[model samples]
Target: MAPNDFDNSIHDFDTTDDGSGPEPSPELWRHTPFTAFVAGEDTRAVYVRDHLPVLMPSFVVDFALRCTEFRSLPGHIARYAESQAWGSAEIEALRSWQRKLVRAGLFISRTELYTRAAAIRESNATPAKIGVIGFSTAGDRADLLLRALGSFAENVQTHGRAVDFLVADSAVDAGHRGRLRGLAGERAADLGVTLRYLGEQEKRLFATELIRRSQCRPEAVEFALFDPFGAGSAGGANRNALMLHEAGSVLAAVADDVLCELASTDSGDFKLALFSDTDPYDRWVFADRADALEAVSFEPRDYLAEQEKLLGRNLGDLLAGVPVNEVNVRKLGLTFLHLLDSGAARIRTTHLGHAGNPAIPTSSFYAPHKGTERELAAEAEIRYRASFASRGALARLATPSVGDGTVSPGMAIGLDHRELLPPFFPVLPAEDLVFGATMGACCPGALSGHLPLCLRHETNGDNAPLHPGEINRARQGSVFEFSQILRAIMAGHQPATQADTTARMQKLGRYICEFAAQPTLDFREALHRIVLTHESQKIMALEHALFTEIDAPEFWRRDIRDFLDHSRDRMQHEDFDIPYELKAGRTNEENRILMQKLIASYGRLLEDWPAIVAAAWDLRSEGKQFSASAKAD
Candidate 1:
């Protein structure tokens, strides 16, 4: 048999033989006594036997599970039965009983297998810090609540981490009653995380905490809160009514305070993730209160959306902030830190405690335009321009008119383009303006153009242009209009690939020669294309690899292939336009980096020095090829 064909039969179907009807084997169960079940022997039995336990309950569950078309195999049936610890003919009897229960609405409408699996999870789980409070109802609908409580109880026994139970509303019913109380009891007994059910009372507690913290520590706290409740009207309560009055303001303020307080705590900065059904809770409250809280509503049908959003938001915020000098960020793991720091942005804070100045304040220090929005706009514009100019800005006026606009004298600009800069730019404007202007003025010689404001002359050169706003605008337009010319001449990939690496490389080689044939290169355009091409390639490669199965191992390769094949019909474009796989192939530069690191870490692991030398040289050759190809294509 061929190497790839060795396991050809592994997934093949055999329909040649007649199938037998489903039935429980009684002999399998008779071997075990009832006493064995009570001692937790059942859990051990499945592992020891390495097969399905032949018993009543488990058999019933497996049979019901087998009702799904794909689970008709006898081995699957046996394993499913064993996982549930079922034995004997009684398994079938129990299965029948469960089916009847489902029909009667005593058990859930789903298959018995689902309930059993859930029950198993309940039995084995330890208390977790968070709970899922989904759409609620009474009676049979209480099953989810019970399952949640059971998970908490089971896990909390030996754990110290806090746990929270969830309560969410669903379309099938109203909210649960006394559910939070019940969950709270279970949590307390287990000494796990507290179970909180948000309501008026909870809101009050959160608000009070917020007010207390803010008044005491001032800027020490901050929050990013999303709508804590479901989205809709606030039930039409009179704004002046005691219950509704100040609710939005009070809640928002409290949320903000709590955020700051939690962040200030020695334990570590923490974020509160919340979902609400009311307008104030979801919008007005969090928006006005916790500037830091990044709250998103749970989708109409998704009970856990809030939970997912919370985890994502909190993790991202924590990771991106200043590294706690005293804390071990590595302990949280890079991925977790990345999630916290780079995920959905929560907010960015600087100056630890200056009662943060709004990035866009409505008022100004001067009169007239002082309070108008235009002042804020101008202030913001200055920063914006400063940033775009390489954060190197200083006041400068355009030279008045150049002989051919080659260099205008009216552009008497500050050393830095600082004056032209908008405040939005983060870098200091004054210093940059001077440095850039000076550099542009002199290359290798004495002075070229008159220094608008000479670095040494405290007052000379006053005739230079006083405004460069027009110059700035002209420069920007020149860039856009000549972008293509720039790409052809100036743009080139760095550390060019070697020739003869791949067909792709050969094409790029040709493209580069064609481009270079043109006369003079626009240095500015070249620089821009180099950046653009590299970025475009990076994005394309990442997306291509993520959507392909080219590098996935055997275990998941088949599934991935199937998914790709299935999705092919939906693709709007053809293969020629699709990006090639971005595999960390043996010859890839990124992979080479890893290899070098490995060699450094375990130098002794390389048994042949000559082989290593040859490989490195080969890689360098390949890189040259790649670079040449990039230029062509």
Candidate 2:
């Protein structure tokens, strides 16, 4: 259709506004009839999936035609239309026509419009002086830009010298309106061009012009259907459906790019780290890997799911099958460690750890020379080293604790497990290969109160256990201890002496065996008892150590007394209860009895305190060291 024919039809649709001009209302630009029509639709699904496929070509054609009409309109007519007042009936008629067009599957939503406009703007071919005008003041400048660009694509495509404009009807305040007009006039003068403010009627003319122009060319609609963002596109489903379908491919490509980049940068020493969260014990291991990847890799997901099958499930389904007893938990933990050992060999890095930490045999299964301890430690060391050695690389296995049992192939720094280990295993090692610990109700980080601090951290002032607070304290303490051990190790240290190391190993073995012996129902209470006994023993030893090993300072005495007093208060409060409920066969009465015995034990320990301190002082002159002394030639 000729441009004049389109303009004539657009003028016919301007019947809504009365010829008598009125002052522009602030709300005039804010009220978009098309927006209201879209909002009133019953379902966006049909419009986005089905209707959009049929409407995009018409939309583009209409938009292009409107730009053409606006370009061709005389300056006087355009100014006259801008001044015309839009009456309520006229607004309603306009809204109805827009709504009908949308319902008939011939209208495009603002989102689609903006997406295309933005793509156009980003293209190098876009003109430098393209003008974008918005009628409403309610939306931000971005929204205005989208609307203007979408409405005048043809002008942007055809003219390289057209500047954008925004004649906001919401500039109702006379002073603001005056300032806007003045700015427009100054800009026009500067550019040696004319800037006319279009009214609601004039905007309607533009819309009608687009419709008339589009109706003349039926084939253009079909062409638009084939455009990716057009209504006629074959797979014009929902907005994101196409993108989602290609997500896997996109991810694969991204992964390939990352691997290529890594290989390019550090050719020989590049680490191909793999981790899995499917095995409960390796949750922290996986987390540590994640932390490492976050630092260097642009795409961490590439490494995250690499070993999903080895763990028998994806990370999302790791905890789906819960273990009912300590045996099952231990089995899972061992399995996780073994899997980690295997995965580490596949990677390029020569360092391998059980759970993202240095390879330390923490389980009692590898404690000292007690039966299979040495054998198992040797087998484990050989197994890990051979994996890397087969690939022409040497693997270094290191541990934070000496009690983990040393093998020739690995280094056992001989640190005390209690001093070096956290209460719960952390995903990342607090110290080089020492995983920090955390306390939670779940298996991976749960603190079974095997440690004295872990038990006390869970207890309240009344001796009743705090639900999560104590657990949180244990977790925090674990991290703190890990940091301390890490710092100590970095400063250069040796393992504990053989005698001290044996004693610690024996203690850990006993605790583990006793814990494993408890029935599921009695596990919690048993753990509590063990923790209490251990704490009492520690206090007794500390009393003796004060005189013999540590200097007896005033602050030390006060600190010891204060700690004992707090423990005594907690034990005395009968109302204090365990934070969690006992298992199916356990009872509160059984727990209560245990608490009574503990309280009595605490009382006895305090009564013997004076004698204990005196005995410790007597032994001070003996000057015996508990830990083995440094070896001298």
lDDT for 479 (candidate 1): 11
State, as a TM-score between 0 and 1, how close model 2 is to the true structure: 0.17
Q: What does each candidate score in C-alpha RMSD? A: 32.5, 39.4
Count of clashing residue pairs in every prediction: 111, 18
Which digits, one per residue and each the tens of the lDDT, describe model 2 over residues 1-633? 233433243333333322112221110000111211222223221232233422322322232223211111222223333444645564343333333443443332222222221222112221111122222221122233233323332333334434333332222244544444454445444544433432223323432332243332322221111222111112111101111111111111010001111101112221111111111111111112233233222221211122111111121122223211101111112112222211111110011112112222121111111111112233354332222122111112111100010111111111111111111111111212221111010012111110000000000112221111123332111101222222222123222222232233233323333444456457545545444554455456445644553433343344344444444444444322332222123355664444333222222222232222233223323542121111110
Off-target runs (Cα >4 Å) in candidate 1 are 1-174, 183-200, 208-633
Candidate closest to the true structure, highest lDDT: 2
- Backbone clash total, candidate 1: 111
lDDT (Cα) of model 1: 0.23
Best by TM-score: 1
- List, residue by residue over 1-633, the lDDT tens digit for candidate 1: 122322232243332211111221110000101111322423211111123332334334334433322221333335556766877774464534532322322211111211221222112212111222111112223344444444433443334323333232112122333443354446444544443333333324433443352332211111101112221111111011111111211100000000111111112221121111100010011111122122221112221221122221222222333222211211111111111111122211000110111111111111111111112233344432222222111221111000101121111111111011110100111211222222221111111111111110011111221111322222111111111222222123221222211222223334434444333334224434443454344345434644652443332233223333322321322221111121213333443233222212111111121222233234333441111000000
